[model samples]
Target chain A: MKSILRLSVNGKPREDAVADNTLLIDYLRDALGLTGTKQGCDGGECGACTVLVDSRPRLACSTLAHSVAGSEIETIEGLSHAGNLSRLQRAFHEHLGTQCGFCTPGMIMAAEALLRSNPHPQRAQIKAALAGNLCRCTGYVKIIESVAAASATTELSA
Target chain B: MAALSDFRLLRPASAAEAVRLRGEYPASRFIAGGTDLLPNMRRGLVTADAVIDLGRIAELSELRVVDDRLHIGAGVTLATLAADPVARARLPALAQAAAAVAGPTHRAAATLGGNLCLDTRCMYYNQSEPWRDAIDNCMKIAGDTCRVATKSPRCWAAFSGDVAPALLVLGAEVQILGPQGMRNLPLSEFYRDDGMAWLSLAPGELLLSVRVPLADGWLSAYEKLQIRGAIDFPLTGVAVALRRTGDLIGELRIACTGVSSRPELIGGLDALAGKTLDDAALSGIDRQIRRGTQPMETTVISVAYRRRATPVLAKRLAKRLWAASA
Candidate 1:
């Protein structure tokens, strides 16, 4: 039941033979040794396993590894370039968005998708995009602030 | 943490081929987005020896308006359907319901077909396998007794799909393909009251598309009562469609979910025809809904709370539709 899967991960081509039931999160964390994507609440309820598949945010835990073959998959490990944090990541840190740090990776990915589609999203829009992700700590005040700050930074850069 | 059982994955090029593969492997399950099925598989609620992925089939992902009806392929993702211009302009109720399902990331992967045919859920039935086994199981699984209503002879798992009630209220029809051939039926006919056999889909049968007719001069609204704004199934879902002329009601259809095993299309609304939806008439409809629905003790909240919320949600949604039509 093992099939060869060929996909682009973190802007690099990856090919591996995987079981039919291999989840995308498992393939990323175990087979590829990219542990930046944390797995919490293996069910689709929690957004801890969020990843970008074909430039869209999706729950990695509920996604099958074989179904997304040949798609560009982005993970937390790919957020920084040349060892410097991405704009969204820097904004998250500066705004004190991480508390306990378990939900940061997924939170950033969800925001990344929102910002990619809407450069200067309003507060309600940012909240709607991150509605699926759960952060028990920080009470979501600073998380929203971080996304708003990231949008402002993008405007300045532009 | 649960893990999926071993299974062979099959990718068919077309719907006909998918049916053929399904016929060849009777124990296989068709997976489009895997948002609902995979988690159930992991929890040992659904057992399948093979998975037939419908994502690669191009024809099944089509969403178009033909003549006067909107034809949405079963494989169309919920996110795509919610954001489609035609759906938003023509079927706003369906668009809102689809947008309200699950969360943003799950909406990106969950398909309309899967949401329409979502599994029945219960507090006891949806638990992990070991947890269910420890409690001696329920009628949804292996046990003979119904935990929700100990003396009842059937399973009372709640059908919590947010999209089906809206589709039902819009007077939609489903296109089904199977080993016998293809046939189209009203969306209401596709559901059965029994939770164990909620869907009327035969073995090896595949749902092809959902066809919703465009109705002129009709306005609709949907409301869902749940604990969270996102990522939670509705405890009570209400949908109302009203066609009015000035202050008089021309046509009205009310439907609800999460109150029973299948979405209930409320009857007895014809009594208020040609009459304005006044406070008295609204209270009458609310009482009718309360008397008709039987909320079981299956979810986190108490049965009384869910039963009480049903009529409130219906009245609120009815008022919204009336205001919009006015």
Candidate 2:
């Protein structure tokens, strides 16, 4: 069953024919060619497929593409503007938040949602927001620092 | 990673239409958040000919008070429930339990109805299709023997959900819509001890909303024990609701999940009323919980650990609620 899904991706409205059973991650990675969103554990165990649906972080692998019709879906690729990395991405890069970079996109997306809502989040709040996302490489010290650094930079700019 | 099995998806606009579609496709299953169902479907633990998505139903997303009782629609997401001011002020246990489920992202999508109707999970049953096939499916699936308890005819899959215990302690009632009509059942009666048939919902029935009587002067709290603080299901989850009458116990209710096939309200607590929650009373309550809960080898955690920890967790919650009343 294929239906036209009308949604906003990366601030652009898209109306694509998607299968009823096609997961959001597949639709982004395969259909839209947004390979920035990596699929770590296809099952909902790992947060490698985290994306922001209507400004809230959701597991793309667990969500159906058609289910999020008329919503704003943002992937990791949406973060950069004019080829420059977003604040969180730059923080991750500078703070050594990525090793293999498998979980970086989902981690940054989850943190992106967190920082948007709570611009000055504490370490515990940052940790709580990204608890679902797992990073095998950084041991979370750099990841936490990355999020904290992004928020601190935001504070400095404000 | 395994792919999801092909199935038709139907989105209904209303609860009545959802029921009609369910009847139209008798082999269909209701999906609210798809957090639990999608994972299970991907693992081949469950399959439906069609999935009747309840996401678009407007009525199921409402959360309001009716006649002094909080009418929480089944479709209300856990994240919304956790952050709701009314839920936090009135039924803090439910809010805390909702916050405690899975992780922040999962809670953003998982619904109250789905959590209430979560499938019973077992170590052997929750595995991949190839893994389960290698050992021959368990009683929950197609096999003849129960994997957790080989000789037992019934499956021992534990109900590891975190929300049911909180609802049970609050004396909640569920509004169920079926082909016959609408009916209400006590939340306690909504579960069965049998793992394979945990929920008491009849075929073609949908849980509409949960009605919880507002606890005016009650101090409630929920505690969960899991391997991790997030994502993992509870090894033992306890919810305690207590109302004090000036240094004496006015009312005390305790409920637990992940200790058995169904989340249950701990029994034999009527004697504790009008008595101060002293050390002796707390110890007595601990004994009662230990006697009531029978943790099996359903999860990766040891039965002995769960059995020992259930009482400690329950007692800690009870004491905290009791102390908070002061």
Candidate 3:
């Protein structure tokens, strides 16, 4: 039950033969070698496998590859351009947002979605947007700071 | 990670086509958002020889208002439903309930039909396959005994969906399509008390849309007690809709979830229709809810806690809604 899936990933169009039951996470990690989307909880409980499906944050582990055949998917690997870290990525790195870095990719991806729609979100808005994602290291103070710092920087478009 | 078993995926373009496919593949399961069904499939709680993806059916994604009733297609995502200005303004309780589902990401993909038809859950039944195997499985899955109440003949899994109680209070009606044809039924009649067969859908049946009547001048609210502020199912969820007339109770409806196998409407409230929502009426409503709820050991939380908390939450919602109407 494999089908040829035509989708746009990281702004590049991809057409690959994926199994009918292949999860989006596996399709990104195993098929395309996009390991930036981590699978912390195999199920949807943990937000570690989050990716943007058509500019909205979605759980990759719960989505089937074929279900999003024509969707525009953005992963953590798509953030950098011309070897320069995206503003959110730079903020996370400078503010020590990554202690173990397990949840950073998903966190940043979720944050990227939030910042796109709302450039100047409040602290409560950031917390609500990332509520689905879980981070065990740094107690989330640095993560919040990282997103806030990214929001304050007016040089680049989210 | 639990691997999902192999199954043929069928995508249908219309509701009629989806129903035809269901008739074609009797063992097929309809999947809308895959938020609830996919996880259950991974846990080995459900199996399907073929999965009918209803996400592509355009007819089932319509959300419109006609003749003072909001017609919400079954495939409408929770996020869309929550953000709809009409839904937010007309049925604030339902919008609040939809917004309060799992989280931002889950609500993005989770649909109204999936939430309405959510599987009943129990602490023992929702575990991993191997974990359930260690306990020899419960009646809801494989074995004959109901772990929550071993002596009982039926499963005691609690209906944990947050949207059902809100819809029940709104007096919603569901449009169902089956081999026989389309028929409408009150949302309250759509559920049964049995956890294993909670929904009243016949074979080859599909929920098409939900029609909610626009209740004018009625203030409503939904409240729930969850272990976490987000990403947790309600231990006890209560929804109240009330209209006030000259500082007296005009109309009142209360419904609750997470305490029984079905999201139930709290009865015996007609007596309080004209009575002002004073402290005495609130206490009376609280006692009625406490007496109506029959929680079992379906969740990690104790039955006593749910029993006590269900009434408190209902009373609080009633008080809040009543005050807001003033």
Number of the predicted model whose lDDT against the real structure is largest: 2
Give DockQ per model, in order: 0.91, 0.79, 0.82
Model 1, global lDDT: 0.91
> How would you encode candidate 3's per-residue C-alpha lDDT over B1-326 as one tens digit per residue?
57788998998999999999999998899998898889899999999989999989998999999899999999999989989998899899999999999989999999999999999999999899889999999999989999989999888898989998999989999999999999999999999999899999998999999999997888888888999889999999999998888878988889999999999899988889889988889888987887677789988899999998988888888888877777
Q: In candidate 3, what are the lDDT values of residues A1-158, reduced to their tens digit?
A: 89899999999999998888889999999999999999998789879999999999999999988999899999999988878899999999999998999999999999999998999999999999998999877458899999999999964533
Candidate 2, residue A63: lDDT: 94
Instruction: Please list the residue runs of candidate 1 whose C-alpha ends up more than 4 Å from where it truly belongs after superposition.
Output: A155-158
Per-residue CA lDDT of model 1 for B12-125, tens digit only, reads 989999999999988999999999999999998999898999999998998998889999999999999889998788788899889989899999999999999999989999
Residues B1-326 of candidate 2 have per-residue lDDT tens digits of 57777788898999999999999998889999999999898888788889999999999999999999999999999999999998899999999999999999999999999999999988999988889899999999878899889999788899989999999999999999999999999999999999999999999999999999996888888989999879999999999999999999998999999998999899999889999988888888888898888889988889999998988888888888877889
State which candidate has the highest DockQ.
1
Best first by TM-score, ranked: 3, 1, 2
Model 2, range A1-158, lDDT digits (tens) per residue?
Answer: 78889999999999998888889999999999999998988888789999999999999999988889999999988888877788998999999999899999999999999999999999999999999998877469999999999998853321
**DockQ (model 3, Cα):** 0.82
Candidate 3 global lDDT? 0.91
Question: CA lDDT, every prediction?
Answer: 0.91, 0.91, 0.91
